[model samples]
Target: MRVVMSVQIKKNASIFEMTREATPKEIDDCKLVYCGHGFFDEADIQNNINKNLMD
Candidate 1:
């Protein structure tokens, strides 16, 4: 089965909110931010790539 996860940041907040998925690999590979800090979402990464390719 495939699972989805999410990471979110709140305005004026230092800590991030993370949601875990059912996949162990996904959880292990998940990082806080794009560069390894702050909050980031996997979906956002894919979206960014798609946007860049379309441009």
Candidate 2:
């Protein structure tokens, strides 16, 4: 599965974002903030969106 990884490129800048493979744990944790294409939503991509949102 895949989902959008909304990460901030800078201060209040969320334009620069990407998609990534959605892990079961991620879904259970409600970490999928946004949704995107699977073409770029590779599992290899590191997802730090949830962490950033907490900050």
Candidate 3:
């Protein structure tokens, strides 16, 4: 089984996100996780666009 997870870091203005395709038990370890590929959607995309347009 595989699961997708997202982590957001407010201070850096960035998000630490990834996906892991592993068994149920493997996910519980908290350390035996694989880094997923590709970039996830930014949470502030719409907000930024709106702000820029308004400015």
The whole-model lDDT of each prediction reads: 0.40, 0.47, 0.47
lDDT (10s digit) by residue, model 3, range 3-55: 54766645424333445455667557654333334444444654553454454
Q: Assess every candidate by TM-score.
A: 0.26, 0.27, 0.23
Model 2 scores what on Cα lDDT? 0.47
**Taking the candidates one at a time, how many backbone clashes does each contain?**
0, 0, 0
Better of 1 and 2 by TM-score: 2
* lDDT by residue for model 1 (1-55), tens: 3233443343432223344323566446653232232344566655654454454
Worst 10 residues of 3 by lDDT: 31-40
Query: Per-residue lDDT for 51 in model 2?
Result: 50
Q: Lowest summed lDDT over 10 consecutive residues: which window, candidate 2? A: 37-46
- Superposed by TM-score, candidate 1 places the C-alpha of residue 14 at a distance from the truth, in angstroms, of 33
Compare candidates 1 and 2 on lDDT and give the better one: 2
Q: How accurate is candidate 3 locally (lDDT)?
A: 0.47
